[model samples]
Target: MSRIPPIKITPIKLIIPAMFALTLFPVFYKIEAQDLKLPQCQDEEIVNTVVDFFISESVWSAYGESKIKEMINSSIHTANLTLKNSCVPMRRQSGKLYQVDMTIQAFDPDLASYRNQLLRVTEPTIIKEITQKPNHYYALVVDDLPDDILGKTDVYLDPQFLILSDQAEKYTLEHELGHLANAWHDDTSWNSSLSKYLEEYTPDAHKNELHAYARGYNCAGRRTIMSQSSVYYLQLPIYSSPDIFFGDETCGDHEHADNARQLREYARRLKDKMKNNV
Candidate 1:
């Protein structure tokens, strides 16, 4: 098995390679109430999440079971830490500390053939087949993802499935999870503005030089983890708070995506469902 490059300490800009292949198209389905019960956190300030990950044959061959397990644990840890500090309800808004308690399980199946089907066809045919259980959120860890698409969330179809590339950055998994929690991208509507800012403020000589997207600091930089991976070099693992504008004090008072609020609201809905046995 050919080895993939180790994850960088600072994630690089996302670029899609034609040779690499993975397909996840938009589709919708009625979500069935999961048979697998989420742990109750109704009176408490926590979201009990269970992540079931399917390891592709390529990943299994490259990293083996032990290393794959380590990667999953590390990803979950990063998610937990990010939510703890960045979530407004958890950290700043309320005195109570709201958080997500996440656990992961690894599954090994004939995913090589399944992936081949995806490349050959458009329909997500075999996802339900290999899922060993119901209710727990599911993910497929493939060797590579195409189209600059590091991850894809199945929020509309089942709201329980995600497709992730093993080659993506460390926080890619968390980014997808944020989507599951109803978080939106922080870079929305800033594409043209960012491009213009870079062209105007960035010196022509230094324009080619790579830089992070910080807004107030140097008229360029990122405050939220939901920003595109291309602008992620200097960003901390934090979400946009709903109570404040995305650009903060220095930048314009444009409305941010408010990922923190979305996550908290999603958690609240989940807790209520659990409490009501819905």
Candidate 2:
């Protein structure tokens, strides 16, 4: 009590700080909601493509398959898209399934490390022999993977195979297939030109739109299934006009056309290489 001088409480300081926080809270909350919003299906073709993918799968469990079908039906109803019966052949026939031994030192820590080491140590000749056909796809579904990795594809391997974690999304299979098709990431140096074009030429009609078409790479104007940075579908529509296409001319003024071209070229080159070896 001897030193109980005036406890000078700065009322103005307390009031100012409280007012500032109240003023900013609503703005911060609104921004966070917008950022956290999940992407919604917008294009009819994209919705149908997703449906077709689920229908084409032959390896999913009965329950898993039913869930995918249910999702497709719900998306269709929500988007008001006409459903069709068409289905393309599954690009990969079921091959020998390998359960990655997560406990092994060869696969310890993370699947990415294991994948890299596996590719490095394993011979292409051995893989080709084991696979029988050099162009047959293989499947490797692991029970778990490092928390950050959903799925991965080794395009360097002939008839590329995908390694997926159990928790991966239904669409992850299609995403890895994009890698198998030799489609580079939308932001990778391989697609830099297209990325630039997307940034500069986003149309007024599409301005402020949040369609799947506008969430790829840093471009934020074109979406592709190959994009590691966007919410996209497996639909690949070719366009004849810039009015419809979202990327640069290297993409043939069409969505997914460049990826298609790359796959064809890769197939041709691989075929030639194999023939020469024989």
User: Best-fitting candidate, measured by lDDT?
Assistant: 1
lDDT of 1 by residue, 51-163 (tens): 65655556667886567666666666666656664442331110111011111121432334333333333223333432332324656677645535667764433455566
RMSD to native for every prediction? 16.5, 21.2
User: What is the Cα-based TM-score of model 2?
Assistant: 0.42
**Deviating ranges (above 4 Å) for candidate 1:** 1-44, 88-135, 190-220, 242-254
Model 1: colliding residue pairs:
213-220, 213-221, 213-222, 214-220, 214-221, 215-221
* Model 1 clashing-pair count: 6
Query: How does each model score on TM-score?
Result: 0.54, 0.42
Worst 10 residues of 2 by lDDT: 16-25
Best by TM-score: 1
- Model 1 Cα RMSD, 1 decimal: 16.5
What C-alpha lDDT, on a 0 to 100 scale, does residue 213 get in candidate 2? 26
